[model samples]
Target: MDRVCDGIAVITEGKKGSWVCDGMTVRKVVINPVKAVDTTGAGDAYGSGFVAGLIKRPGDIDYALRLASINSASVVQQIGAKHGLILRALPQGKKWMHIKVEKY
Candidate 1:
């Protein structure tokens, strides 16, 4: 985890999830299901949100976690890694992308 502090590592746990730490402070932890889609590039989306939050408001751990969580959730709802995902900014764009989830 300390390696994450050096900006050299990011942890990804299959059953547990991913964790990023800075020196002694834990940056982010993301948990995903064991059975899911390909999950390719999912980490990119997560990292992007995390970095964006960090840049927008540095040291705001809670806000960064929330943003990363929302993005991660969105990524898992698709059939492929990057399908059925939408990114929009309010005011400029108020459109909606309806995604149906089937529960068994």
Candidate 2:
């Protein structure tokens, strides 16, 4: 939670983590977690791939979000984060891809 009193960027990450600075300019960098299995760097790879998608098609937040979600889902499906990873391109003729709906 943050409260903008005057002109400051007050960010609180957790109970013990907090920072206040000028809101005009700020750089946010997230640290990627290292995998113990060492199969591959799946999380970092997914983040980079998502960034590439955003760059290739700017202003498409929905598409970018989907790309990121799919990448993350694929990563967790295997024993190792990067093991058995598959990347599929969108079908040329289809405007939307068909996804199977599962009941939990």
Candidate 3:
């Protein structure tokens, strides 16, 4: 990742986890488990969330990854791609908790 681009590079791995590299350090995002009925819009959800986080908080890769993970997770819970997507702020309750990340 570092040899290729100078910006952020991300790889989403569904339930297993996700990885992010910013030309320097690499971080691993441990996503919370969710019973997925459909995974149609998971990638789109994560992309939007990650971009939104970057815009909301510049240089905050962790926030971006977490939001992306959360957004993707939500989409997989419902039958349709967009049905389980969040329309407003961060989800409320235990099922919508933040992602756990580790630096590697």
Best by TM-score: 3
lDDT tens readout by residue for model 2, 28-95: 22222323344245555456545655786885433443354344444544676665344556435432
lDDT of 1 by residue, 1-104 (tens): 55325652446443355555545455445443434555665666667766676777797654554455445556666666676343543112311112111111
lDDT per model vs. reference? 0.50, 0.42, 0.84
Off by over 4 Å in 3: 93-97
Ranking by lDDT: 3, 1, 2
Higher TM-score: candidate 1 or 2? 1
TM-score of 2: 0.41
For residues 1-104, could you state the per-residue lDDT of candidate 3 as single tens digits?
Answer: 88777789888887898899987789999887889889999999999989998998899888888888888888898887888776668877745445788998
Error of 2 at 62 (Å): 1.3
Minimal lDDT window, size 10, model 1: 95-104
Q: Report residue 50 deviation for candidate 3 (angstroms).
A: 0.5
The window of 10 residues in a row where model 2 has the poorest summed lDDT is: 95-104
Ranking by TM-score: 3, 1, 2
* Between candidates 2 and 3, the TM-score winner: 3
Quote the lDDT for 59 in model 1.
Answer: 77
- In model 3, the Cα lDDT at residue 41 comes to 91
